[model samples]
Each structure stands twice: as C-alpha cells, then as structure tokens.
Target: MKKVSLFVKAMGLGLLASASAFAQYNPKASYEGPAKMNTWSVSIHGGPTQFFGDLREYDFYPVGNTNSDSYSERGTWFVGAAVGKQLSHLFGLQLGANLGNLAGMKRRQYFSYFRSNYQQVDLTGSVNLKSLLFGPNKMKHWKIDGYTGIGVLRFKSTAYQLGSGRVQRFTKHNAGDGTVTPAGYEADWVIPIGAAIHYEISPRFDIGLDFRINHVNTERLDATIGGDNSSVYDQVGSRGSFDNTLARKGSSSLDKYGYGSFMVTYKLGKNAIRVKKENGKYEYDTTKGTYHLRWTDPRNLIKPPVILTLEQIDSVAKANRPKDIDPRLLLDSDNDGVSDYFDRQPNTPAGSIVSGAGEAIDFDKYVSAALPGIACAEIFANVQFDTDKNIIKPQYYEMLNKVVELLNKTQCRLQLSGHADRRASDRYNIALSRRRVEAVRNYLVKAGLNDANRIVIDAFGSFKPIGDTSRNGLQKNRRVELRLVP
Candidate 1:
C-alpha cells in the first residue's frame, strides 16, 4: 500500500507539472489588447490527523500478545500560514509553516488513580512546503478555488497529568481549575497531504479555509497507560510482563502518527497582471498629418488639397493608369499636413483618438446609427486595403458605395481616412493612404453627395493596422477604416 501510494503521488505531480508548463504557451490572442500584468494571495486550513499505518494499541487483556489499553488525546490540532504566486486565472504555488499538537491516549482508570493526557509540540521545520491545485476559474475578488498539496512535517511529544504531580496520580483533582495542565514533547518527520478552498479578497490578498491530515510515520507517540513507553512491571516490584511499546522499527514505525490542522494565513505584496489598451497601432510612420483622396461630396472633386502617390493611383485605377490627375503628384512635395496642394494626401484617418494632436477613439457605438462621416462615435467596419498598399482599392467600391449611399440618404457628414501596410516607407504609405482616401472623397462629391461641413480628413500616417503585418501580417496592415458618429 505504501509503495502504491508513493507511485500515485509521483504520477500526480508529474501530470500537474506537465499541464503547468504546457498551459502557458497558449496565450490569449483574442484578449482586447490592453491587460494588467501581475498579482498575489494567501490561505488557511484545519482538520483531524488520524494515526494510521502500524499503530499498536496496548491491551490490558492478559490472554493475548495484543492488549487494547485505554487512552485519551495527548495532543492534537494544527495551524500554519502561506505565501504564493498566481500563474494564471487557474494555477498557483505556495510556501508555509505547520504548527500544532499530535498526541492521543487511552484512559488509565482502574490501575491508576490519575488521568493521563498525552501532549506534543510540533516544532515543525520550515521544510513544510505544499503545491496548490484549483478547480473552475480563479483570480477574481469573489472567485472560489479548490487546492491540495504535499509537505514535510517535524515535531515532538510528551505526557501530561491533571495535577502538577509527576507519576501516576492516586486521585482526581477538582474540575474546572488550573489544576489540569498540558505538557508538550517532540517528534520526527511527517508527510502531510491535504486540500483547501480559497477566495480572493483582492488582487493582493486572499483568504481561505483548508483541512488536511498528516501521517507521522513513527511510534513511541502515544504515551499513556495504553502506550508503549509508560513501563509495565510485576506486582512484586520486579520486571514481569512483556514490553507493550507501540513504537515500531525499520523506517521508524510500520504504523503512523497523524494530526488534523486548521489555519488562517494573510498574504503580503502586490503580484497580478493587467492588460492595458493603447491609442495607436504599430505602423512605420512618425510624422503627424492627414490625407485626402476623392472628396466626400461625390458630386465634386474638392480637387484634393494634396497629391496622390503611385500606390494610391494603383489602388483605385487598378488595371488602368492615371487618366486626369498625374500619378507623380502622389509624392508630397510640401510636408505641410496636406500633399502639395490639390494632391490627395490631406487629412489623416478619422476616429483615430490622438493625444495633443492624435488619439484613437473607441468607436463601438456610433457606426450603426450615425452619418458615415461623423468622427469617433462608434467602431467602423474593417476596410481591407490593396496588397502592400495603404491605398484604398477599387475593390472597396461595394463597401464604400454602401457608405456613400448611407451618407447621401442621411445627408450626413463624414471624415475620410488612409492606411498602409508595413511594406512601404511611412511617408510613402501615409501619402498613398491620403491620396487613396481623397480619391474616394472626390468620387463621392461627383456622385451628387452634398454635405461639405460633414466631411473631415485625418491621416494616421501608417500607424494603425486592420490586421497583423508579419508576413501573414500584410493582410492586417493593408487597410482603411471609418468610424461613424452623430
């Protein structure tokens, strides 16, 4: 049984270790970009520890080698504290100390006049360490979790009587008085295995209750009339009967001395992780400026305040070449937020909530109800861009048409935008993005769109991305987006 138990423990630890290691590789990719980074917590527990394995009960019966003598609890009750790290929402590890009593006995009524109380001082060493296992979710102020672990236990033991008298008492002392006292002894190593349930009170503190039994694999523990050490001589004052000691040999004892403990531990320190959301995307540009493409009022060109880049023309022209406006103008000559006047790159993308000058806005609400050109009221749809280009594509015609239709019908305003994947220079992409959007604005104006006041332009200059750009990232970077608002 002992061998099997040891094997089971080893296998369990192995499994937990394996899971602990593997679980981390699976990061929450879907997490909403911003999260906090660290946290800490604590626990307490108590219960009964039964002496199992090879415990010997001295029987007063003369007929058999085994005599079941009577005895009471010489010592019992355990307590401890722990500190640990939360690896995730579900797992953690802790270190603590085990302290308390581990004694028991039988009543020595007939042969002796005094009551026997076995007592022990578990001067448990710091080696007592434990692992934690939890069920369900973890890491919330009110979250409940279950845990279990193993550790090393060390202690000592002693016998105590009701009176200050040393030997067997000849009479009973008055009850309810200090006449009855407790004596404590010490003992060996113990293997403690137990379980507990805990609650996180806050990010840095948690409180819990635990119950576990410790198996002190030793004897010479029960020191009462029924125990092995009290001695058993003849009626004539000479050595007679056999030794009734319950303590075993080999690995100390074939039997085990165990105790149950309950404890409360308050943890200290800050140690939890929180993901935080930021304002910008990872792009290639540094300058701050807006871009332009077609005018939003489709019926007019608004003839862009900036020039369009090659990528920009390719985006809208696709299989064709520049018909009216020269493509070279796409290269901004003036660093003036606008592309060489009348060129497309003008206002940067809208809804990009910026600091001082640019901030990315949270647009989850306005896109569905407001006018197409409103700024930063709601999350706009993800607009796909041309390959390796921040340029708006003719491919976006359908989606853009939807926007145009919505704007025309509502006679609403709009802020145009531009974006570029990481493949081109920040300046090039930003400029291209500006021109592409200006083209859209220009087309809208020609298409009978009316509101000029409702139209605004903002260029992010290759900063935010609709998708990832690392190889498979192009699909992410290549794009433009619109946040609608009232």
Candidate 2:
C-alpha cells in the first residue's frame, strides 16, 4: 500500500512541476507586478471505517487483554487553518494545521450482532500543500490541492459488548436474587495516520470536502467460545464447550475507517507587492531562486508551491464542497477590496476606488486630504439653447453667472456630454449633439475653466436615452449633462 501511495505521489508532483513551468510566464502584459503570491484558508472534513482481520483493538493498539469485546474506533472530524502561496499562475503551495476526530477499528458481539468500531481523535500541528490544478486566473474562484504531514494526535478508544439490558452495578452469581448493577467500561490512546484532498473557494475563504482513513491497532479482548462452569462465560458457562476457539492477534484485530468533515476559515492581512529603488526607479529580478532583499517589500516573494499527499487533498476537498457561493465575490465592481454583497454601495461605478462601505472616495482627495477635490459647480453650467438650433441662448445669463462663479472659485476639469431626441437622422442628431456639448464647453472656457484642454465634450446622438422614447421623454433626453472630476 505504501509503495502504491508513493507511486501516485510521484506522478502527481511530476505533472504539477511540468505544468507550473509553462503556466508561470503566460500572464498578459496588462497583468501588473508579480501576481499575488499566497493565500490564507481554513476547512473541516470526515467518513466510515473498515475492520481488518479478527486481531481486535488490544491485539493491534496499546489496549491490553480484557473481558469486554474489542470495540472499533468511530469516525472523526477536524477544523484547520492554512497559509498558501501561488508558485505559478496555475500552481501553489499551502501549509496548515487541523484539529478533529478520526476513527479506528474494533471487534465485538453486541445486541446479537458482531459489530466493530474504528475511531481516533487528533489535532493537526502541521501540513503541507501542493496544487496540481488551479482555478481560472480571471475568476480565481476554485482550486484543488494535494497535501500531507505528520502531526501530534490526542486519541482514545473504548471497547464493550451488550450487557444485561437492565442496570447491574455488579454481577449476581446465582441471581435468583433479582438485583442489578451498571456495567463497567475502559479506554486507551491509539495514534492515527490520516490524509485528504483539499480545495479553496477564494483567497481568504475555502471549502474542503474530504475522506480520511486511519488505521488503528487495538488491545485484544478475547471472544471465548469454550463452554465453562465459570460465570464469566455467561450462557456458554452453562454449556460445556470446545478447544477449537482461536486467539485473534492484535495486528489481525487492527481496523481501518474513514472520516469526513467541513469547515470555514477567515484570514487577515494584505496580499501586497514589493518595489525597490534601483537607479532611481524600481527594478528587481523575479527568478526562481531566493535572494536577500536590500529593502522591504511585503509582496516581493514569489511564493513556492504546496507539497502534500493526495489522500489529504481529497479529504479536505470533500469537507469543503460548497452548496452555494461563500458570500464573497471573485471580482469586485467597486474596486474596494470587499465584495459587492458585503459592500454597502453595489452600484459605485467601475474603476472608482472605494471604501469598505462602497462609498467612492475622490481619488484626488484620497491621495491627499488637504487637497479637497474640486467642488461640484466648478465645471458645470446649465447652458440653455435655442428651441430648434443647438445654439446657446442669450437669455440664460443668470444661470451661466453661477457656473462662472464656480469656475473662478475653484479650478477643475469639466466633462460635458450632449444628447438629442429621435426626431432627426442619427447623423444629424450626432452633429446637433456635438454642437450642444461644445457650446457648454465654449461657455465654461469663457468663464475661466483655465485651460480649454481640461474641458472634454462628447455627444450621444440620442443613443443614450434618459427616459422613455415619448414626446416628454424626448424633451429630457435632448439635454446636456455636465460633471467635474479630479
């Protein structure tokens, strides 16, 4: 079994190494910096046990010989935390620890049925991960990894068979005297070896659906078939029995079982990149070998791959099978690190940087609080035009005066977009719209927007409707909108 497991590991690692080589350099020119390196994740997993030969718990594990039948270990569950690094676009590595239950085997006759249980408990102190297949780059929503490691496990097991249904504090020898007593029980420690497959749902969050199997050697509990005149034999005591009854060795009594579990983990910190000043500008080599840094860059390290066992990967993946989205978005529309559902403002325009609340922080103000972004009225004017011609009407001087006030008070960039109704040809509408937007620009310039270059004008040509395509809607649609941006 160990040889087979080793062969599988060799194949998996070889494939991942080959793939990572090609996948590393495939990023497009638009991808900035060395991509994010590592991730933090957490999860839980469990499944059934398989009893081996009749060696029993005592025969295999540390439990000693006893009158009680060998009891198998029950299944187990564990929750764990991990830190991972993307070795390449499609390959990564993770190190983590887990605490959960595991199961071992047992042999016993209970309630008229010969039943055995396998159960063990453990706390994962360490684990290693290596990804063979990673989720899509644009999506970064799903990924799978194989992992394994040795960790200390705190374990125990109990062995028992059906006692009298009635409570018995002690056995009555010739119990025509109908009094009863509760039966006694015993337990012991048994080390466990376990593994699983794991998957990540997102950088900070993950889902693991896994099956872990553990082997347990137990203390032998004899199954006496010989009929004896001894009370220890119960019914068999009443009947004389034979010498053919056998002894099940501890190794033969050893058992195997599977456990499955699920868990959720949260991570804190930023996935950053590092830049150093070289010849007055930032430059550094991103080679595979490690090097000491002259300066600090939180994101400089290209993370290495996770190196783990396949069995561990499967177990972890099974534990984290997601039924629904984990409430985190792979792509944030607001450019706030937080996802949309969690972000209070879902509709913040794209490319606009935002706060946790999704509120757009003026970029210029975001850069420096002292530099207050240009005020609203500085770059806009209600430039009324002639009813039929796209010419600025002289009657709107009062409205223009306010616009002039803003431009003089605060220098800002102006954006003017014009629209027209569906009454004219698309070409004619575009021409008229251009005149309308340009008229507003020309006025803003006269009112001292400072540079004509800072003013931008665009025409929609009735292509972008503000309301319904009706007479009233047309009136609203055939208007110009102005905005100020820093």
Candidate 3:
C-alpha cells in the first residue's frame, strides 16, 4: 500500500510537470502548431511480452530448487491496435485493443503449467514530449509520448499436470470454485502505463517504438496460488483434487506483464495531415491538409506591359508643358520690324522704309505735319468702380465703347490707368488696381477693337487719387481712366 501510494504520487507529480511544460509552449513561435480538433491517427504494433507472477521463478532458479530448467518460460508475443486523437499540442487520448498469450510454470511444491489467451481494451491519456518540451518546429522529426490508463483484461486459461498429462480448463465460477454453476472466463481490471518514441517519415505516416507495463488486479491469473485450503482454492476446487500437489503458500503481491514493440501509425481524416509552402519554405498545416506554393522572387510572376493611347499621351505631355508667351509682347500684325505696342502705324506695306510708327511715309510730308504743331489734347474717359470691386457696371459700358470706337477711328494707342481706394494693404491695393485695368482692357477688346495690343495699362494703386477724402470720393478714386495717346 505504501508503494502504491508513492507510485500514485509520482504519477501525479509527473502530470503536473507535464502540464507546466505544456503551458510554456508558445504556439505562435512554432513553425507548425497544434493539430486541429478531431485530428486522429491509427496504429498497429506487435512484440514480445513477459509476465511476472507467483507461478514464475522469483530468480533464475526454481522457487525451492537450484535447477534452472524448472524456471518459468520467458517468451510470448502480443499484437495490438490503437486509435488516438490529438486534443492539444501537449495532450491526447487513445483507445487500444490487444490480443496475446501468457504462460508460466511452477516445479518445486507442485509441478503446474498454465497457458492463457488474453484480450484487453484500454483507454489512455497521452502526452507528446516534442510539443511540450520544445514546441513545434520543422527540424523536430522525432516525437516521444508517454501514456497511462486503466483497462479491462479478459482471459481463458487451461492448467496442466505435467507428469499425468491431465488438462483442466479454468472457469471463473467452476474451475476455481467448488460449485455446479459455471462462471465462464475471467475479466480483470488492469492499469497500463508506457512511453513511445516515433519518427515522422511524412505528414501522413510515422513509425515508433513502444514499451508498456500492465498491472493486473488479480493473483489467480496463472491458475495457482500457494497454500493448501487457501480461500481461492476453497472457493473453487483444486484441479484433480490434488490439493497438496497444487497448493503452495500464497503471497500478497499481484501479477504484472509488459511488452516492448514497434509500431506504424497513419494519420486519419481529411484535415489530419497537410504540408504548405510559405516564404520560400515548406510548412506542414496539420489543420487544413493542404499545400501552398509561394514564390521567393516577385519577378517570377508574369505581368502585362502598360500601354497608353494618343489622347492620354497628349494630355500627359500638355500637363508638363510650360505656359504660353504673352501675346501682347509679340504682336506684329503687319509683319513690321517694330512690335505693335510701340508702332504708331501697325499696318505697314511689306518692304517699305517706314518711320517708328511702322508707316511708309515721305520725309518732307512728315516734317510739314509735325511743324504745324498738331493740337493733340488727350481724349479720355474715367470709368468709375464700386469700392474694392473690379467688375465694370452697365453704365460704364457706353463710356468704354466710346473709347473703343476712338481707338478704331484713329492711329492712336489707348492707355488704361487703374486706381484703388486706400482701404487695404498696399500690396492688396496694387493687385486690386491691376484687376481694374484688366477688366477695362478685356471690355474694350471685346467691343470690336481690331487690335487688343493697341491698349496698354498702368496701375497707380491709390497713389494718383483725383478725388477728395470722402466715401464718395474714395469710390470715384477706384476707377480706370482711358487716355488716348497719338
């Protein structure tokens, strides 16, 4: 009982340690993390088994003799199959079935031999060492797991008296019990604890070596317990009534057996196994059972060339082009050497030697016209503006049209001098005056003026005010004056 208590404590501590180690595993750091829910695997294994019981030799020699030939046989075989589910990276559960034969003999007190065929069903809790200790990594191709569980064992045994060559099949109620009713075979509770190490050859398959020990609850497994008139012998009759021959002193220790085997396991289910390629490397996806192909170099992917239409190309070219030159500076309507702004006569005959007016003139006729001292009083009109406004009112249109008519009738250039009130900053006033000049220029140009270049502008920006210091006077100051220059 003390030993049993210690073993249970050891197992409990081992489980706590396993849980601690499992808690340390970080799934995000693992190359391939835990399997998804319902992931399953099936395994088959077979190997030699050994039994330790009261009927077997305690040492290499027989119980009360030095003869080694009287020792119990040591060789037997067992085959088993199991189905398991990975509940997490660190833990899982397995259900297994095993079929095997057990045999033992005693020679000193009563020569006896018992051969039994047994079947067992077990359910175990399993822990994966690889996942718990190191987490999941691609380099870890080997996995070790430990498992422990309770199960049921069913057996049918036949005992033999070696010298007489007599066989007696033991039934639970009749063979060992001195009763007329039969109790069939024996079913015993067992505890199986073991470990296995596996090498993963592929995502779907693995091979492993397993070792396990099963602790049985009953001491009657070999059909012989020591002591004449023992409780077991009294309950069930001794074989052939040879009570003295068959009975020996019994001990309190129970029987145990174990096996060392090799197993091959295959993962089951559509999502039980998979491999994927990511960032130029292969990775196993245990959840989806699929593969993903990734390119290391982006250039490996095919791409179409870009093409542009003529209209689109033109639009792009225009967006990047420089602004056009001012037309006023370059105007030479008569193909004259002098620009239109300085030319008095813009329409000059081609190849004619003209004066600065760009007109073909007789030298003597130019002196006579100039000596008469042409009475040139400036013909002008002042177009008033609203305070701080550049828009030309409808009443000012007639005055601007008269200026336009005068410009068409004579070889004269018009000067538009613009002004603003002293209400804002000097810079703003300067800009306002410029806008007033441009407004008048645009109106005169639209009113049938043959050449807009004939009109020039000067902005005073309230410096040349022709009115008094009053509100009405300030409005009058914000005006453009058209002065004709001959």
Candidate 4:
C-alpha cells in the first residue's frame, strides 16, 4: 500500500509539473451556446502484469525460477486497446479489451505453480479529477482521470507439481460430497478500477501512463484451492480436485491481478493547429477548426462580465468628454484675421485690412475717407438665434431694424454671415446656417431698406466657432454676425 501511494503521488507531480509550463488564453465572455469540439478517440497500451491469488508467494516481487524441476513464471505481459468518447470536460466513457497471462508460484506453502492465459472486456466511465478540483482554466494540457467499471474474464489454467512437472488433476471433492471433475476453462466477473495521467501533445494526440487492478469473482484463478495449505508434501497427491465445488469449499478471497501500462491516444475530428500569439493568446477559428473536448471547457472560452467602479466610470466619462474649443478658434474679439492669442494689435478696426501680425495698415488713409474707392469701417450688432432654430429672435428685431436704417441712410451695404453651434452634423449645420443668413437678409429688406440687393449673405457652419463649444457655452455660437461692407 505504501508503494502504491508513492506511485500515485509521483504521477500527480508529473501531471502538475508539465501543466505548469503552459497557459491557455480565455476569450471574451458572452452568453453563447457551447461550441462543437472533438470528442472521440482511440487508445492502445501494453505493460507488465502480475497475479495475486492462492498460488502467489509475494505481494509485489515475483518468484522467477525457471528450472526444469521447479519451473515458475511469476510475471507476464498484457496488451489492451480502447475506444473512448468524452461527453464533457469532466466525464467520459471507454470500451476496452485486454489479453494477458497471469503466473504465481509458492515453494514454501504448497510447492505448486500455475499460469493462466486470459482475456477480458469492459466498459468504464472516467472522471477528470483535475477539472473537478480546479475549474477548467487550470491545467491547460494535462488530465488526471479515475475510472472504474465491470467486465467479464475468461481464462484457461493448468497447475503442476513442482518436481514431477505433471499436471495436477482433481479426483476427490474436499467436502466429500461427490467426485470432482477438472474444468479446463473458467469464466467470472471482474471489476477494474484505476487511474491515469495523460498529457496532450497536440490537438490530435495524447500520451499517458495508467495502472489498473482487476478483482475477479472467484478464487480458483490460479487453478488452486485454499485447502492445500498443509506443509506435508504428500497432501497434493491425496486430494486433487480443481472443480468449482472443491474450489468453493476452501475459498477465502477473490483473485486479483494488476498491470501498469504506457498509453498512446489518437483523437478523431477536424482539428487545426493551435497557434498562440505573442500576447499569450490563442488564435482560433470556429468556422474552420474545432477545439478538442478532452482539453477544452466551454466556460473557459467565455469572457467574464465587465464591472466598473464608480470612480472608473467617472474617469472614463471625463476622458471622452469634448474639450472646450481652442481659444484661437473661438475668440477673435476684434474680428481681425489674427486670433487674440497671437494678435499684438487686438483692437484693430473691424473693416480695416490688417497685416498678418494684426497691426493696422494705412490707418490714416482710412479714417478721413481720403483715399479714392476706400470704403468706411463697417458696423452692426450681431443677431442671435435659438438652439437649432433658424428663426430670427424677437430680441434681435430692434438690432436688425437699426442695421436697416443705417443701410438706407448711408452708402454702407449689409453683409450677413450666419453660424451655428457644433452640436449637429456638419452638413445639417451648414444648411441651418444658410437658412439663418437668409432670414436676416429677408428681415433687413422687409424693415424698409430701400434696396434689397444692398444685402449679401454668407453662411459659416460649425467650422468657425467664436465661443466655447461646451454645453453651457454653445449658445454664443448660434448667431449671425452683421457687418456693413463695400
């Protein structure tokens, strides 16, 4: 038992050591149906086998005497194959068949030896212990499974006297009920229980090591009964019944045998090579290739829900919020070509042609109307509109009236330049600005201006902002700037 415990621990460590070297990338989470994955597989294994029954002398080490006088074969070999299917990440089933030989000898107790050739078939269910203990995310390519199931075994055995090398045949019943007849081949039920560790080498292949112990329903597997325990060497010659009736009379415990084998498995399905990116993420295409069910869990492919704290939400909102318009795009308080940010002459006249540096050019030539064909500095107050509205507001009616009075009184011609806030699309805002310019031009003509042709209109949409574009400052941008031009 101690040796068996140590072997189990070693297998577990091997699984963990290999699994720690790899990691699978988890995809973004959503509530999607499970994906199709490769599930069917085939495995083949073979290894040394040992028998434990009435004819055995030791628990682990076998007696290996092959002398002609006392011929003994204590260890043999077994070969097996299985077809399996994974129903889920945690559970699967396998149908398997094994053919092997069992041998045991006892020189001290009864001076007898037996060898049996057997075949067994079983259907077993496997539980993935690693996935059960750690959620599917851990152990990317390693699997540890515990399996158990029932089978039927058939074996033909012959017991022999050690020195004489003669077959031991039954004559008299141990209980003295009746004469006993020797049976050639025996059939019994068997339960196999074991565990294995498998490592996935790729999408299509896996390799593993497993140890299974089979418990048989009868004690005559070695063709011997417990009644032959007497130290007297002549006792075997007196009563030599190997029949079921004689075997049952001296039955103490069921027979058992165990084998440790190396396994190779091949999975069947359409699987593509898994590629991992430099970012430690797997690149997978569901349309072309599938993940294997033995190593994949549907839940691990899903991304977890996104959760945000109050501070994080606030931070995100602040980062994406529109910033106040640049002061250069907003404020040119003197309507000069240069913005106030770079303007050395911030107070240049509205109608004056200024230098690139905003310094007035030929100021004296403009103030006295001394230059021929030189127009006077234009003047008018701006007309405001409501948000997204093109209608001229009532408060701006008086302002438009005064502009009309001046246009009729002087030779000054009115220039209507309309604008809109940045809240709407550029195309829509341009149309809105045109309508506002036309509204102002119509108002000036209706307000008793003599020549309607004296007014010229231009629309500058949200492209030009003379004020803040923030929520509280958007209103200042929704207006028409009026200037009398040449």
Most lDDT-accurate candidate: 4
Give me the runs in candidate 4 sitting further than 4 Å from their true place. Answer: 1-33, 68-75, 169-183, 227-240, 243-249, 272-288, 305-486
Off by over 4 Å in 2: 1-36, 42-140, 165-203, 216-249, 271-486
The better candidate by TM-score, 2 or 3, is 3
TM-score, every prediction: 0.36, 0.30, 0.48, 0.53
> All candidates' lDDT scores?
0.41, 0.42, 0.64, 0.70
Which of 1 and 4 is the better model by TM-score? 4
| Residue lDDT tens for model 3, 388-457 | 8899989767656655555665566777888888888888988999999998898888899887887788
Deviation from native of the Cα of residue 373 in model 2, angstroms? 58
lDDT of 3: 0.64
What would the per-residue lDDT of candidate 1 be over residues 199-279, giving only the tens digit for each residue? Answer: 444333445555444554344343322333424321221111113222223333333444444445444433431111246
Q: Sort the candidates on TM-score, descending order.
A: 4, 3, 1, 2
Top-scoring candidate (TM-score): 4
Question: What shift in Å separates residue 163 of candidate 1 from its native position after superposition?
Answer: 12
